[model samples]
Target: MNFFGTIFSYIRETYVDRLSYFPSNIKISLMIILFCAIAIVELYIYIIFRRVIKANQNKQTKYWKERIGNMLASVVVYDESENTAEIAVHFYDKLKKLPLKNSTVNQILTSEIITYHKNFTGKIPEVLALLYAKLKLDKRSKKKIDSKHWETKIEGIREANEMGISEMAEEIIKYTDDENGLLRMEAQAAYLKLSNKDPFHFLDRAQERILDWHQLVLFEIITKNKKLTIPSFSKWLRSPNDTVVMFCLKLIDHFMQFDAAEEVQRLLKHHNTRIVKKSIEIIGKLELEELEKHMFEIYFDHTDEIKLEILNSLGKISSGKYADFLSSRIHSNDSKIKRAALYAIKRDADHGEARLLEIYHHTSPENQALITHVLDNRIKQ
Candidate 1:
């Protein structure tokens, strides 16, 4: 053993001495090559480790999904018993015994349950809600609502809302005042879902501009719930937040709350151009003849956008009484105004075609072209 050790030491010393004699550049180059080799080995090991982890995760996901899918299928197909509540309890008991109740498994169950919950309504969804609550997934989601991560909290709110966890409404409402816009929107949607007693409660105090996408979502949710006691949207028409007022206008238009026609007429003279424009649209839709004079009164006090909207409203109203205003605009130097006037006139074919022919004989070429386009292109069926 001593002889072998001595031979090894001698060889290593000889190698080190030879390396020490190498020029500085060659030594650096060799050191770089050594480091590169080490990095490549480490990277290869890391890649292999990641692939192994991914494969294991995929295997576990498949296992849990299969188990959960079987449970869901049994609920929908195999369980012929009309008593879904009892079956939901029994299935939840079985679900609790499944192996590996980790985050991944929980996520899979959540996604699966949400898919079924959205597809069905009435007692079916109610039973699934019981299953979700019994599985303690609702508790997990509630815990996530308090998570330090914003996205996690949003996901928690969404899960609670989608699963119909009404108990979490107060907890969800706390985030409605969050600084993050997406988080705030999600929280509001959750609140709307869980708290149907007063769905638009947050809108009363909302400070931000409710985006168009958010409006569409809330509209769908509110409109679909037949049991909901929809309050008077006119209460929000005077909101200090323009977005709230704007959203209220849409609600009014959609519900066709003719009682709010008085308020809608008053808003036509609002200083905000959007409020005025939307008011015009709602007026036209409701066909509140009393509101026509308000639009005509404010016609010259607003911008071109408001002007076009007013003309559009006049066209929609299609009453012969607004013909004088359209006739006046037909002679204006602004071609857009002329087109709007022509459109308004063309809309009133019963009373305005004679005036259209009479104007064609005396108007500017631009006005005549516009008249010709309207009379030809906007033909009545």
Candidate 2:
């Protein structure tokens, strides 16, 4: 106490005594500045301390992950009988011995298990699923699914799907039409994986537009899973949502559902020209020659874009029956329609080349050039 009193007396004599000579306002300002400087220094030190603590935590997490990963690897490679229960117990025991809080350890363990599950197949995935349940890690994911936060909900949906938690299907399906696009996409994917009965039942009730990327993901999931039953997409051709109807059209073309020809013919007269165009394309690809006459009837009533699609569809059909309709469009003011018409005429297997030559001399220079291009086998379309 005497040492501190001597230091305080010296500091007061050296600094505080000198400040008394200055004006009172200046003195108060100096004191305020001094306190602020001290505060800034203390805050800097606090930040450094926090960074040090975070670094140590990261190191500990990495060490625990490596240890957990090795244990999981051992469980995956056990070539003995399919005794997942015994294996799960042993795995859980090893994880419990780790020197970390249960929540932290479980987080790292869950992540590592999912990584392994994504890479493996057959019995290994089954064993990993068993381990995930035995440790009660699924509860964490389920809770996240119930989170008000959308990002957390997406993570939970992904985890449940990867872990094969089929019982979560009912809860997950509700998010399939979520206002959030990403969450809706993840939920849709999870439903496809988890549900066995009426896997595509969501389509019947989906109100939001299923974007192109979403469709791609769903298509990949469906095609890769051999056991997944392909639904009759023609059922949704009359859907109120135009995008849904378009997606169904793509699926119909892909699966070659010939029975959908009647339904597809109906869409050609639908109000949305985009859907009508898609319907025309599908009709051509499926070689629905019966619908060719209906396409001819609507060809004059639509825009050039739709007109171009009809011409292209006629080329695909190449039934030679639409030669008169193809030739009538050869004089169209739009160059695209003219070229499409010429190409369709050239595609006809019967008398198409001869028909092109017959109209060559009488047509305009631009039409002649297009015809020449179509006729020349060396020119790639």
lDDT of 1 by residue, 1-381 (tens): 699999878756644766688788887887787689789999999999999999999998898899889888677663444687787877777788865268888888887888888897666676788888888888889989999999999989989989878888888877886778899889988898898567678887688777889888888878997867888899888888887889889989989998898888888878788888999998888888878889899888888888888888888788889887788887676778888877877777587678888889987787777777888864642
TM-score of each: 0.79, 0.86
lDDT of model 1, residue 217: 80
Give the per-residue lDDT digits (tens) of candidate 2, residues 108-184. Answer: 88888999899988777877898788777888999989999999999999999999898888889899988899999
Q: After superposing candidate 1, which stretches have Cα over 4 Å from the reference?
A: 1-59, 99-101, 119-124, 318-321, 346-350, 357-373, 376-381
* Per-residue lDDT of 77 in model 1: 62
Q: Count the backbone clashes (under 3 Å) in each candidate.
A: 0, 0
CA lDDT scores, all candidates in order? 0.83, 0.86
Task: Tell me the spans in candidate 2 whose CA falls farther than 4 Å from its real position.
Answer: 1-24, 27-31, 34-38, 41-45, 80-86, 96-101, 361-369
What clash pairs does model 2 have? Answer: none
When summed lDDT is taken over every stretch of 10 residues in candidate 2, the lowest stretch is 95-104
Assess candidate 1 and give its TM-score to the true structure: 0.79
Error of 2 at 19 (Å): 9.3
